[model samples]
Target: MEKKCVNEKKCGSCKYLHMTYKEQLKKKEEFVKHELEKCPELKGHFKPIIGMENPWNYRNKVTAVFDRDRKGNPISGVYQEGTHRVIPVEKCLIEDELADKIIGTIRGMLRSFKIKVYDEDTGYGLLRYVLVRRGFATGEVMVVLVTASPIFPSKRNFTNALLKAHPEITTVVQNVNNRTDSLILGDKQQILYGKGYIEDILCGCRFRISPASFYQINPVQTEKLYSKAVELAGLSGKETVIDAYCGIGTIGLIASKHAKNVISVELNPDAVRDAIVNAKVNGIKNVRFYKADAGRFLTQMAEEGAKADVLLMDPPRNGSSEEFLRSAALLGPGKIVYISCNPVSLGRDLGVLKKLGYRAEECWMVDMFPWTAHVETAVLLVRKP
Candidate 1:
């Protein structure tokens, strides 16, 4: 029998908590196989799903919303799915243990600090949410305070208290998000303590992660996923590679060591900035980052008569756009390694790629979100000769 979480029904984060890990893996494998069956080119090319040996507490990034219970005590946890009700979680099974503890400490200190929880309805309070990110290999921690206003009273004392409680914390940043929308972060930010960012090692490559950058939530599976992605690319140190939707240049930098050169592109300026720094930090001189839309960049590369040996694309959950797919064909890379978080979108894109003269040869799944229903996939497609 599988162990159950105390607030399992309310939090609704771990959809497969009731099922054993083996059963969960089987379910995801079957789901991916079923999704891919829609595309004929991908049929009979499915590989076994990669499941984690220890799946619990695998989430490196933890975000909890702040609110007060009826008794006026401060609390922090995730919001109940599809609703605004905040489910008070003392500890979560999927989150990092120390990160969760630090969040709990912050919640406990709110009352003593005379800090008010942000009220969504009345547009009041200081803190709206708390986000914690920990580096698995380096044990570096970054705490981001999402606030309704920039002014934080007694912030110095609060930072000192938090550091005293959890000395492992490397940095603290205050992000002002005063909007009424559901977004977690705002445009404005200020560093309250330490450096504004934290660094971590992935696939022997160091990466700088900021509050807004898109780093994979699961570090353990990320290594497997990225290693497999680069392996499937079949880089020969003589091939030019393109890494699209490259956030902070994680996959690009990892693949750089094996390839002749890598061109990474992202729309977010902050991520592009971090990617450039990450390449320098790793002393990887063969890779360059561009702050442009992936589709547009690929289209221009094709127009410039440039050719790449491999194309590495990790698009959003919605998958790659048709414009990007068409341009990828125009560029005509011999192999295209597509990494996707959503299988349904992956299948749709596979069909589009097949029409554009590419065929999915092999595909594998990595269990990035253990108890959750989500799975990550990497597919290798070769140009149809």
Candidate 2:
């Protein structure tokens, strides 16, 4: 029997809570298989879907928006899907227990510190959103208070109160978002406590996770996913690997162990910085980090006559762009490992890559996100002879 979620409709986080856990995984696996079947090169190549033992509370990061209710009381939670109305979640089954408690505690301190929730209409308030990131392996936590402006009234007292309540919190940061736009994080940030970032171990590598670093939410499955991706690359300790869209160099660093060298490219300069630091911290000498557009970098590599034996790409939910596929085709890597969050976009991109002399070999579904419509699919593409 499926466990009914209390905040399913209002929270808008889990889309498949009504179905049993088994049904959820099966549905996701079938969905990926169905999408990949459209491409002739991907037919009958999907491996068994990897399901989680205990999928609840797997998310390491939680983002809560602050707003006012109809009665003008401060509220915090996720917006109701596509709107600005905060859902006011007291307890979420999927969220980390301590992180939710901290957010709830901060919500209570709003009145004590004279903090006003930001208003999207008037844009006159201070508090905007609360972001909490936890290190699954290290038991360290980072709290980021998103504010409309740098001026936080009684900021010292507020942070002290939060730390006193949650002694396990490692860091507290205040990020200012003066714009009226929908971005959750701002440019300017100040550390109110501890280091501005937390650390976590994934696949035997230590990674520094900042308030904005792109660490995987599901740490356990992340190890499995990266391991599988590296396995599919079939490195012989002599191959040159290119990690594209490499946020924090998670995949690139992991691949460094098996490959001779790794070149990781990311668009975000901040993530690239963290990736560089992560490589040094992990004592990995063979991986190089580059802050550039992955497509343009691959194109440049092609123009320079540099050859990559394997191209490991973990694109965003929207998947890789056609330009990237063309660039990848020009580079002519022997094997291309694609990690995708959206199977539809993966299939669409695979079609484009097929025209680039790449044949899809094996696809596997790894359920990093449970009770949700989202699934991670890893596919290996071998260049056709």
For each candidate in the order shown, give its overall lDDT on alpha carbons.
0.93, 0.90
What lDDT score goes with residue 157 in model 2?
Answer: 89
Once fitted onto the true fold, the runs of candidate 1 whose alpha carbons sit more than 4 angstroms away are none
Candidate 2 local lDDT, residue 204:
92
Candidate 1 lDDT over residue span 140-236, tens digit each: 9999999999999999999999999999999999999999999999999999999999999999998999999999999999999999999999999
TM-score of 1: 0.98
Worst 10 residues of 1 by lDDT: 37-46
TM-score of each: 0.98, 0.98
How does model 1 fare in lDDT? 0.93
Candidate 2 lDDT by residue in tens digits, 1-385: 4566667987677999988889989999889988887577666677889988988889999999998888988888888887777788877777888899999999999987888999888978999999999999999999999999998888998999999999999999999999877888998999999989999999999999888779899998999999999999999999999999999989899889998999999998779889999999999999988999998898888889888889999998998889888988888899999999999999999889888888899998899999889999999999999
Q: Count the backbone clashes (under 3 Å) in each candidate.
A: 0, 0
